[model samples]
Target chain A: MAEIVGAYFTSHVPSIGGAIHRGLKQDPYWKPFFDGFPPVHEWLAKVKPDVAVVFSNDHGLNFFLDKMPTFAVGAAPEYANADEGWGLPLYKTFKGHPELSWHIIEGLVEEEFDPVTCQSMLVDHAISIPFELAYPDAEQWPIKLVPIGINTVQHPLPSAKRCLALGRSVHKALASWKGDERIVVIGTGGLSHQLDGERAGFMNAEYDRFCLDNLVSDPDALTKDSIHEIVRLAGTQGVEVLNWIAARGALGPGAREIHRNYHLPISNTAAATVLYEPA
Target chain B: MPSELEPIPGTTLFDGEAARKGYALNALCFSFNEKVNRDAFLADEAAYLARFNLTPEQHEAIAKRDVLGMIAAGGNIYYLAKLAGIFGLNVQDVGSMQTGVSVDKFKAMLLAQGRGESYEVAHKEMLNG
Candidate 1:
């Protein structure tokens, strides 16, 4: 049976790929942002894990305006790339675990989170971009993945509290799994940014820092904010932070912070990622 | 700019903006404003929702908006209208009820309001003063 070795929380901004790989960090506006991190390539090479349970929200692919699941997990042998109408890259599909995925689905449901399971699914930048950062060489990814997708685009989204609660439940599940392999759960999204309407390019670093602080030290406080208020405070994209709630939740109120960093540059937004280990 | 407007009043479960976007999207896609198609859709409704690529969120939004006696407090007009057709009614039936019209008679008046002319229809089912 697999046990969760640790959890990862990250920002899945599309621009990071440009900075880390192509040296988009050289661009005047993009340079300062990438400067904060100490060589992402070097970092990923070190903190390798066996499998990752990735959390992300879809951006108009697979699911559409007609129907969107609140939380959906894929149990396929692998998931393919998302087109997203923006000509997304066509990458190798992610491998999934139906038995484990169903077990998670049932456990989450029993814990009061209605997570849906899919046999096959495609992932968007929210998941794919981060995967690239962690697994620069796709074929040699150290971690097999349990991709948990959320509905951040459609509104009245799950409250940050509820998302956090779901994470806690997932942690309980890992303990019960009885698997032998070590697991790493990852949550991906924002640290304060919006991508719509008059408030389109909104950013609030102070709030981002506060959020990161609470995420590692005192996550219970995060449960206080409603999804609406969070969205209002952080901006539309900021709500994606709810994804991180899962990473925090997996630690079950007692985890040590492994690494943390924050930056704001070209996209005119704040981004951060935190690593945690169970107590 | 309905997207910019306030949420559909009393829509508590789903995202108001997406709900609103969904309404306009519904109108654009299905155009339930036409009587014949509306009737046809509502006529075999169960088989209908199954055909499209409606997300669970959109399906929930439609469910909340289309429940009986509830006001169409949502943005997706096309599905809402299709729902009205399922009940053998229209926006007039909805509006007339607001003005104290009976649903049964609202059905009758709508049928008599000339074939396929949805925009012009009014509720003769108004309650007796």
Candidate 2:
């Protein structure tokens, strides 16, 4: 049967792509973080999952104002690569597993979480960034994907509570899928810090640490906090922590903080690589 | 090439007023009428600016509609489309409406028909950016 053999929590900062693409890794400032992330790179290379169910918020490519779903799963077979300004150097289309994608979609719906399904779409960084760095070649890293686009970009987005509930639903949905291949659930985006206006340089190491600590043990407390609290502490866009909570919730209490790293100088926010569920 | 967005069909996008509020809120901040809303926003630019730690030039790009520059300024694609919609342009089109046409071909058709006859402040990228 299909199983979530593993789960990963990461921060997919777009500028990181800019930094790496520009060969900034050797730059004194960014070198440290990349050093911390290599083990994560190795883990993904090893797990080599059959499919990656990604959770991220669009910066606006796939869904726009006409309609934005709090949560949408891509049932599409293909997604085009977008030139996300800093130039997403690695560009190749993402292949979606329509069969598994729709199965998760139907399952989520049956669980009462109405998720939108896109048959054709253009995925922005949310799906591409980690993907580019994690899975560069189609033949080797042939992990089909199921993208769960969250509305973290929009305000009054689903509450931390709602997102966790949805995560729990995802756990149940996948739990019942009968397949032999292994799957990896990845929650991309966030630790503290807001990168906008006067808040551009805001960094909350205290909150970042606390959140990471609880993520392995008590996720409900974080998920129960109001959006207002999350924004007040992490900045408005920082609420993307909801994605982290959802990932933890799906990984269930079986998760272990196998690995954790934080680097904020590159950007005000923290970047971490956490492994959940012992294989 | 459909007359309207095919309704994304069965998803509950939101419950009741939630979706409406999202659209209205987005429109209020990013729509062409942003100026009208700015009076209220301006009352407390500090609070507004604090939400997004943008540089002055960055703020100007968003206010000015330098699409590409705005993207570099840290703006996302959705709000960019909202800005486009405010300028009487569709999100998919480029310099001339004739450039990016789709099912809403009529909107593009109407836009291309009026080409350079009239202009809006937000329509000029070089002047603004």
Candidate 3:
């Protein structure tokens, strides 16, 4: 049976991608943010999970307002990256794990979490930046990917509790996989930064710290807060913390926080990364 | 009609109704994802919007480059960011527009209270005043 190794959480801020693509990692404004990734690289080298189940919100890449799936799973053999109109360089097609994807989708539905399964989806910066940040040297990602899309663009988004439950379902499905595989579930986005309205360029370092501490030690307590409160406190884009909570749920509680890095104002985002290994 | 679910006062919730009203405008903004389209819009702003069959309100919102007006007219922030980027406008600029404050003040507000007070204090002020 496939054994779940751990989960990783990180921000996929597009500016981080721009800095890396433009080779401005050493530039003063971006150097601190870039400096935070080496520990992740070192940790990845150590555990080296064979598969990464990524939770990200699409920024009008594949799904627009036409039909936004609350939860979309990529079951394709491969997923492509695209330029999200800002001239961000595209990465090579990411290989997918269709068998595991299908199993997980089926299990999620059985577990009462209806997922919109996609055989083809163009991934945007939300996934690409983190990929580059983590595996900077690879022409292609070293591990197979299972891209899961969560709707954070449109309102009426799934609650943190629901996202957590969905993560639990993902864990249940992964546990049922009969093949030998080491896996990582990654929830990407949010350290309390807002990107629009009069309140744009918002960051709450204190709130972000509260989130990090609670996410590691007391996630359910964090889950109790409503999205309204989260939006009020964390800012609109900060709602992406729900993705982090989902990643925590996939690990099924009692995972030890192995590594974390939090940095601010990376192109108007409170960037963060956390790694959890099962205790 | 607004959603039966009571509206959050300070928000323009992008629910189904907003999506329907803003479909053409968002589709137009979504086109800006391609470099050619962003160039075309920059080259001839009027002609670019004409291609989308936008409502007069949407055209006005785009014409004035009003981020708040665009949101009120059903523009999603992610799509609007592309449009804003064309003018060298960043998220903070759009945010300042929405908050009805100068960019400097907006940044300062973020540093001070974030959105912790926006919904409760600002919205109440907007609603009452």
DockQ, per model, reads 0.05, 0.04, 0.38
Predicted candidate 3 versus true structure: per-residue lDDT over A1-279, tens digit per residue:
676778888888777776887899999867777787888898889887899898889998788887889999999998898767766677778899999999999999999888999999888888877888889999778999898888988877888889889988888888788988889888898878777655555567777888899887688877887777788768788899988888888887678888887776666677888888887
Supply candidate 1's per-residue lDDT for A206: 60
**Where's the lowest-lDDT run of ten residues in candidate 2 chain A?**
A194-203
**TM-score of model 1 relative to the true fold?**
0.68
lDDT of 1: 0.61
Q: Local error of candidate 1 at A80, Å?
A: 0.6
Q: What lDDT does each candidate get?
A: 0.61, 0.62, 0.80
lDDT of 2 at A111: 84
Scored by TM-score, the top model is 3
Q: What does chain B score (TM) in every candidate?
A: 0.36, 0.33, 0.83
* Candidate 2: tens digits of C-alpha lDDT, residues A101-209: 7778888888899888789877776667676556544443477778888888655578888888888888787888787668888888886644433223334556777
Candidate 2, residues B24-106, lDDT tens digits: the string is 33443343233443444547655664554456656666565554444444444345444554444432242232222242442
> Can you rank all candidates by DockQ, best first?
3, 1, 2
True contacts kept of each: 0.08, 0.04, 0.42
Question: What is residue A35's positional error in candidate 1, in angstroms?
Answer: 5.0
Query: Which of 1 and 2 is the better model by lDDT?
Result: 2
lDDT of 1 at A61: 51
Model 3 segments beyond 4 Å from truth? B1-11, B96-129
Worst 10 residues of 3 chain A by lDDT: A195-204
